[model samples]
Target: MTLIDLTPAPAATARANALPVAIIGAGPIGLAAAARLTERDIPFVVLEKGESAGAAIREWGHTRLFSPWEHLVDDAAVRLLGASGWQAPAAGRAPSGRELVDEYVAPLSAHPAIAPHLRTGVEVLAVTREGMDRTRTAGRSRAPFALRLRLADGTIVDETASAVIDASGTWGQANPLGSGGLAPLGWDAVADRVAPALPDVLGADRERFAGRHTTVVGAGHSAANTLIALASLARDEPGTRVTWLIRNAAAARISTGGDELEGRGALGARLERLVADGRVEVLDRFEILRAEPAGDGVRLHGRRAGEAAAHDTDLVVAATGFRPDLGMLRELRLELDDIVEAPRRLAPLIDPNVHSCGTVSPHGYRELAHPEQGFFIVGMKSYGRAPTFLLKTGYEQVRSVVAWLAGDAASAGRVELTLPATGVCSTSAGGCC
Candidate 1:
């Protein structure tokens, strides 16, 4: 998380002072940016693709987050929520995704300072300079950004802004079932049988999974969460069976924290107990190559130990993790790392091959800056293909970026972050998968 040198050119500075800053997405990080901007008295607008703030989190509302309330809530949001007499959740409690949205994100969005600036059901189709594309560079830094957005009423509108902060998260872009990151053959044909990464097994989605032979793919916290839920479901419905698949030869990648482990530690402990009880069959070294419709379910084709292997199951939860959507930023000038697609200077700190322990140093506006000034991609989207991003890190990112935007150079340059060390080293650079 080294803060690279970022001296906004004179032309870019002039443009930044001209109009309101536009923020993309209204998730936690996006709202955090709005909070910071509100505190600074900066004019800003939040464009959310979903109908309301934290809509994405609502999709996986049943799954509990490993991080506690303290780590999840941003400082600026707390300040605003406190003024409105909002009661904070217990710091030690690890809340479910839904609780995070309902308690913190939703309240923060509705705060008087943020509500007027927020616009939900507005999707940013593209972001570029007002009068220029990627090819044009003359006086590029002086031009305001033109954001083409699709409104809730199915009408397209173009808005102009002095700066753009893309906090749009990676939840929408799920990894495919095929090996090598490409979609498997006939992936679309079996779309109906492919279960999402995070599903509420004991809740609303119970009917789709109970008493069914399910296969949980990927070896990450998400997969672990699903496996734990499915195990609970299996206890009541003895006919239900779960198969855990991974590319690694062993389950060592699972983060089983020490006795001192607290919040997320419970998840690790639960997973360890589930493995010990042999509740879920482990299929190690299974590289999924393809998926096809097999009767009412799916047949996954892959290889294990140089031998072709196939698994037919009623449901396939490909919790292979997610990737940032780069499609919307095509017209913007960005210097991304060849491997991770993260900001060039920031990739080394997050690349799985380099930092396996998930300890990213503190970084800020400088590290997130792009060739196109006044533009920053924070949150999980900043990590690109890497999955090492934490909510705390995203909060820190907005704090610095907003500080810089407000012309507080001192605060922007002095970025600080403290994160718990995961002693476990991941086989993949990001998280478990």
Candidate 2:
């Protein structure tokens, strides 16, 4: 892929250099971009909607990551952290979400070079050219970006930047539990009974799940993690019952790489033991059609195979995955695929339908470019609805994008990434987590 011409006209380049490159979200990918910019001596600012860095990761802090420390840490971040005498975590050790934030994200955000440019509790509502919308084309590349932000204290703020990098992730926009990718009937009315995808079953949310009959929907690893946790809860509280629901005819969707995989393989093995011991009931080929309020809990109506079937449960966990939020960029020019919603050029490379190995080739500024110059959507949000995103892939994306922004065309064009191969492909034909 060819890198776009990042250098502006002589007059525009002068003006652009005076302004800071505004980055949205303070997650790992966003912070890594900041570290790269710092190394290049580029002026930039980071805006996070949450009260602190890695705010989204904190929601599922109890869950351990499938990748180890070697795959999770970015090179630029390590260089910056190493200068401050920061010790790295054990190379082979896998960290929980909380530990990742506390050890890596928090320290990176506190670095002198990055800390001064970071701003938390600031939500970017919209992004557009200073005086032009998506319709205009002339001089659009030269104009600075205008951002509409919502502050923490119920106040609105307007900010401008030479360039905008949207690293905002897709954690909050979860897929629905209903069949055909739509919300089930009476879903909102019975919303109170539904549990978050990755709840702290054995910790803070123990009371809500103990002694309750719960059904987990989805065939991804998130579902596996929740099912394992529920089994542990059932062991302690004998009254607690757990059921797993999936649309596939067989449980082969669980791809266990055996000894080939590291942290993820161990999780797959634990889930296999649970299935063998009959601790968690697996209902395959079950498609949810509707959900209705029944007594204190909810009754789920669906079809098992071709016939009709239903299940009444006290709670449901929707681990169906998430989609990117494109509402904020309506006014900005973008080229997205119809199905995956990722950048047009990137969809073909990462689409689960075309590539089912759960591994995507490395992509950089070339694949991430949009019609609007100096604007990029990176990290998990760049993958749209695809679940094949890895932290290693996201780090490579920022490294290349930042190099281009800093006028290092050759560096930006050379994209390389190394990912652990999954021996088994996903049986459901959907991207793997």
TM-score leader: 2
Model 2 lDDT tens row, 1-433: 3234544321245676589999999989999999999998989999999999999888888888766677778999999999999999998777888999999999999999999999999999999988888999788777889899999896997888988899998888889988788999879878999987888999999999999999998877788888999999999996899999998876553567643345566767888889889998988898888889989888989899988998888999988888888999999988898999999898988786555334578789888988788899998889898877767778889999888888788888887666667422211112253
**Tens digit of per-residue lDDT, candidate 1, span 159-246:** 8998999999888688876778898877898888887888888999998898899999887778888898999999998699989988
Local error of candidate 2 at residue 380 (angstroms): 0.9
How does candidate 2 fare on TM-score?
0.93
> What is the C-alpha local distance difference test score of each model?
0.81, 0.83
Cα RMSD to native, each candidate? 3.2, 3.2
List the candidate 2 regions with Cα displacement exceeding 4 Å. Answer: 1-13, 251-253, 258-260, 354-358, 419-431
Query: Which pairs of residues collide in candidate 1?
Result: 352-429
Q: What is the lDDT of candidate 1?
A: 0.81
Task: Give the Cα error of residue 156 in candidate 2, in Å.
Answer: 1.2
